[model samples]
Target: MTDNLNEFNKGELIIENKRDKRLDNALLTTYEGDTLLSCVYIEHNSLPELSIDDVDTTTTFFGKQVPFPLMINAMTGGTEQGVEINEALYNISKELGIPMEVGAQDVLMEDMDTAELFLGEIVEEVNRPTVLLSNLHANSSVADIKVAMDTINADGIALHLNPGQEIFTKDGISNFVGRYESIEKAAKEYGDKLIVKEVGFGMSEEVIKKLVDVGVKNIDVSGSGGTNFVEIENLRNFDYDFSELYEWGVPTAKSIINARNISKDITIIASGGIKTSLDIARALILGADMVGISGEVLKYLIHGGYDYAKDYLQELMYKTKIVMLLLGCKNIEQLKKTPYKLTGKLKEII
Candidate 1:
């Protein structure tokens, strides 16, 4: 609300509607593909001397231990609905002691005032989430990263790769030539603090290997089985037909394996279509250091409001612990090493 409603900046108007459109599309769309997490089944332990009370979900994010490995992930910011979503996700992250990576900070560079509105009263240090990550695009400059982090007081910055969305969206970047070089430079300056992420289409072995070779440590595959930006952009305009690309991208489970195969030092964040406790456990078992849920969480928040969102995540945590107990794992480390077998299409791919 920095500008007058009557005379809104035309550029901001487009972004505002785009943000609203994403949420609107998300509210109506249900993913039709599989994340292939079902292929990863944690072998149940009949006797481990571990009770339900002994199960622990704690894991490290940005070098800080949290109650669980699940993160809310980047969704939106800079608009009215964007503000609400950030605040709700922020509160949930704070209460649950998890990370919350906000959507791209492109707006913060233009208008710093929106940063205050984006995160709400939590702009103050003591009130923010335990781990807050600012987001930017893959082709962003180091200066952009610094400015975005400064504007939002973020602990780190995530440089996201979304070539598919960029190619299809109106006025989106078509030439993605220097993204890797830019990311390499950012990784050098930020070290492990920089996260190179894929925007839902998932990451391939080649891309994962390239990122690892460039000194990037933190990675969010953001694999398929969740939200589809191409579909969202296509839905935004019914005149065009993008139905053929709906089933594109790598599944979340397979994406994690791709990263894991690249290097053990690489920190993997499994996301995209993470809905159930089984999904959470499967992600961990598949080599994800942490799990992220965005589309599903947004769906809950939109339909049930803040209270419902909180309750839904709480129940998810409970169910995740139950999965750990069944697997005879007492903590995250145990769960990571838990036995799993691959079946179906996923089994053939990896």
Candidate 2:
């Protein structure tokens, strides 16, 4: 078993190597250029005409008043390079008054030294009333969840589900049998704090119902049609097994619509392929309480540096204001009630 584990770790290292090599290429190709999907489309004759400053963007999340309803989604934070990325993200998040989520803490769960080096230090450097979120894989034990939360003093624990990524990953764990039960157990044990998040693949209406039944309060609709984790994993492994599944899950816009229709009580975070402020507005109109950004920001930060990423975020903010003004909405809540037509693939899904 030890030998098997060692081989698996080595394979993972190789996959990581390939991923890092293609990182710049992917970012440059997708974001710096424009082949990426925005996942938002304005209906014919539906554009609103208004001044940008007249648009209000403030919204409340987790009882905290955030200036914008945007969050930097969990991306990385176990390796040395992850530490630097987290620090840069922290500074930008603090300045922007947006929440930030760190990558999964599986490494920290195993080693106290690694926890202190990677997770603990990142949280400390971000020193602010910022919404600091910690992450755990769905199969994480209750004890592991507690350790992850305690290690980072997380404002909320994000339980990430990524079975598709696992299947494509060369050295991945595929024991997703009792994830619902495990999440339920964690929520029951730590009901006041934990937030469940889907990674890349969106949650079904059935799964959403089950989670709500299990007492989970917050959900990130990390839907499909954005950052294709299956594609990413397949590229890393040189495999085509799950390539079809790359377009398998629901879109972020559709997920938010389904989730809102089912339960308006839980906080809904719309993510997946969200890249611009127009995407943010479309999500809000569809009932997203907050929008989580990852791939787009990662692209900028990794290639162009922190200043470039900050400017990108500022551009998104500017776009969001324009969206609000056009919709004749003042704040995020008004944006939610703003009338608009959902067409294209979004109409088909929702």
In model 2, residue pairs whose N, Cα or C atoms come closer than 3 Å (at least 3 residues apart or on different chains), thus clashing, are none
Model 2, 197-312: lDDT tens per residue?
Answer: 88877888988888889998889979876777666666657635665555677767777877887797889988888887777878887888989998888877765666778889
Candidate 2 wrong stretches, greater than 4 Å: 1-54, 117-122, 125-127, 239-241
Local error of candidate 2 at 86, Å?
1.2
| True-vs-predicted CA distance for residue 344, candidate 1, Å | 0.3
Per-model CA lDDT versus the true structure: 0.83, 0.73
For model 1, what is the alpha-carbon lDDT of residue 32?
77
Return the TM-score for each candidate structure.
Answer: 0.92, 0.85
Kindly report the root-mean-square deviation of model 1 from the true structure over all alpha carbons: 4.8
Which candidate number maximizes TM-score?
A: 1
Q: What tens-digit string does per-residue lDDT give for candidate 1 at 215-322? A: 999999999888888788777766668878888999998999999999998889999889999999999999999899998887777665666777889999999998
Model 2 RMSD to the real structure?
A: 6.9
Q: Pick by lDDT: which candidate is best?
A: 1
